[model samples]
Target: MEINVIEKIENPLLNRTEIHFDCTYQGEATPKVLDVKNRLVATLNVDKNLLVVHNLKPSYGEGKANGYAKLYDSEENLNKIEMDHVVMKNKEATKEEKEEAE
Candidate 1:
């Protein structure tokens, strides 16, 4: 699977960064991970140490459904797994500081 970051927006109310990305499944006629002409939203909250992601638009077409994955950086390693949300936190950190830390 291949993914690319498309756009991003900072949400002050949520104190998180919302990232939109274009994902493509590179294989032989495999199902897509997301719907076409729709955007996927991933929220990264470092202050709360959480990452929440969801499909902004659900797939309406027939066939296999799209998939989503949550990734995290822990213990100096990157872990990719299935999850609904992710959380992390550290002292002496501001929301702006945390976003820059990413």
Candidate 2:
């Protein structure tokens, strides 16, 4: 999978940077949120704990996907600004990953 950052908007009030990006995976299935999040972290050179992937949706029958993510300046702002489930979603590992680790 390849990631290309499309846009970045800084929100000082929220203490976060909102990112819009595109993902291209010609032969692979839609990438998982965690997988994309990991890539974003590396690409942005930020701590994984500070990033939250809000959405990732594949285009109909297309090898491309578009998504939105946010990078908070701190974890405190992240927990305060984001929904509880969303924060948990990013923190928890996938079930398949857990099974594989066993």
Task: Quote each prediction's TM-score.
Answer: 0.36, 0.90
lDDT of 2: 0.93
lDDT for each candidate structure:
0.38, 0.93
Model 1 C-alpha lDDT per residue in residues 11-62, reported as the tens digit of each score? 5544445556545554334433332222232223232223334443333443
> Model 1, poorest ten-residue lDDT window?
82-91
Lowest summed lDDT window (length 10), candidate 2 = 85-94
**For residues 1-102, what per-residue lDDT tens digits would candidate 2 score against the true structure?**
999999999999999999999999998999989999999988989999999999998998889999999999999999999999888878866799899999
Which stretches of candidate 1 lie above 4 Å from their native place? Answer: 28-49, 56-102
User: What is the clash tally of candidate 1?
Assistant: 3
